[model samples]
Target: MTTRTPLTRARLATVGAELADEVGFEHVTASEVARRCGVRVASLYSHVRDADDLRALVCLLALDELADRASAAVAGRAGAEALAALAGAYRDYARAHPGRYAAMRHRLDPATAAASAGPRHADLTRAALRGYGLDADGETHAVRLFGGLVHGFVTLELAGAFDHSDPSPEVSWEWSLTALDATLTGWSTR
Candidate 1:
């Protein structure tokens, strides 16, 4: 006879996040999560509709954490300073939490995305670009450009793709930021 520990959506989400960190987000399962919590698979069904729901919750959690980090990094900063800070904050967070970082990219349903921290992320990006005086299209372009740069660079960095290089990634990262700043400066008021 086993005692069933009480579970909540929050606890289930936390456990799912931890499992993701251990076994890759794509491989995390409700059954495994239940195992970790010493509960039956059916027990998790009550807490989460299914595995997808668990992943969605983890994704939202990761996005929220990232928004918080970006908010702190960009606070009281503007223009290139804010851009660099935001980029660095994202890079640092991704490196620190690879699993959670991966989860942040997971696609959420429209309604789920509306309620997720993803909007805050977009707003922060727009805020950082405000000092450049870009038109709506320009801001959109810059957002996509910068977002792609950060995500691609971090993904490559984490995959050990830079391990063969002689230039330390630290140096490369700074160089990339410098280039990004220069590009933004050139694009401003254009």
Candidate 2:
């Protein structure tokens, strides 16, 4: 039997995230991850509980990354500008890391979800909405609306749904942001 070297949980998570980007998040396996790390499968058990745990860890990593990007993008901006910045940041991150982006949307155990960077994401969204004068309900609505648009556009773009379009994905992305800004600005209380 080959000797296995110990890997830290952080190292394993980084490798797992990279592997997810390589072969798709769903295809990531502990054995394969261990192989990539030059360690035996058994060695990974000491760092990660199993495939589920690794996936959750990956989700956490993705969430934190996305939150950081969004926060940075929206800093020193407000209103539609801030919204556009945040939306663009999210789309840019997702496009750059499709597999990791998918991992961010993966459902996690309740405890994991509660403890993950999800709250940070929510706070970022809420902060972005401050410029729009959105209250609690309006902020929630804006969040869902923006989330749907980003998710829908990215999903379609990734699946080649816009490949044959004339305007190009980038152009459409800009137009979408413009339209989103208009919608948020004109939101009605009725």
Candidate 3:
């Protein structure tokens, strides 16, 4: 007889994330995860409260992973270099793990959100903007602007919005970063 590996929330979440990658995040159901795990759907309830709980676990996993990548990408770097690295981390992760990227946007309960890597992502953004020499309010504004630009661009790019566009998405990405750098450089003076 084969001994079965113990099932845990982490393992289930990992499987869910993989499923999301294959079938899209919206299609990651607890039944599907159980099927992949070779277990009954009812068994998974011992570890996760329900399908929503499983999705939330996957969301937490994605947030933690994204923050880790961003932290590493920005380490020992500042200004435009740090900005580019941070942005690149997001774009690359979204491109490579579209499902996990979608999971990262999942809404969590207040306590869960506060405990997740969501705050670390915020802190990393604020830290990365430190070299821009912005005041407190400026820092807050800059973080919002940076997130909006990168998220909007990546979302559109992933949807193939720039696939047939002229000048290439590569060219536009570089230009956008350059413009962002220039804007941040003059932010204090403005």
RMSD to the true structure for each prediction, in A, is 2.0, 2.4, 1.4
| Rank ordering of all candidates by lDDT, starting from the highest | 3, 1, 2
lDDT of each: 0.89, 0.87, 0.92
What's the distance in Å from true for residue 126, model 2?
1.2
Best by TM-score: 3
For residue 119, model 3's alpha carbon misses the true position, in angstroms, by: 0.7
lDDT of 2 by residue, 13-110 (tens): 78889988888999889988889999889988988888988888888899999998999999999888888888888888878888888898889988
User: Using alpha carbons, what is the TM-score of model 2?
Assistant: 0.92
Which candidate would rank higher by lDDT, 2 or 3?
3
lDDT of 1 by residue, 6-76 (tens): 79888887888888877788877888988999889998888788888989888988898899999999999
lDDT accuracy of residue 32 in candidate 2: 88
Quote each prediction's TM-score: 0.94, 0.92, 0.95
| Alpha-carbon deviation at 71 in model 3, angstroms | 0.9
Which model, 1 or 2, shows the larger lDDT?
Answer: 1
Candidate 3, backbone clash total: 0
Off by over 4 Å in 3: 188-190
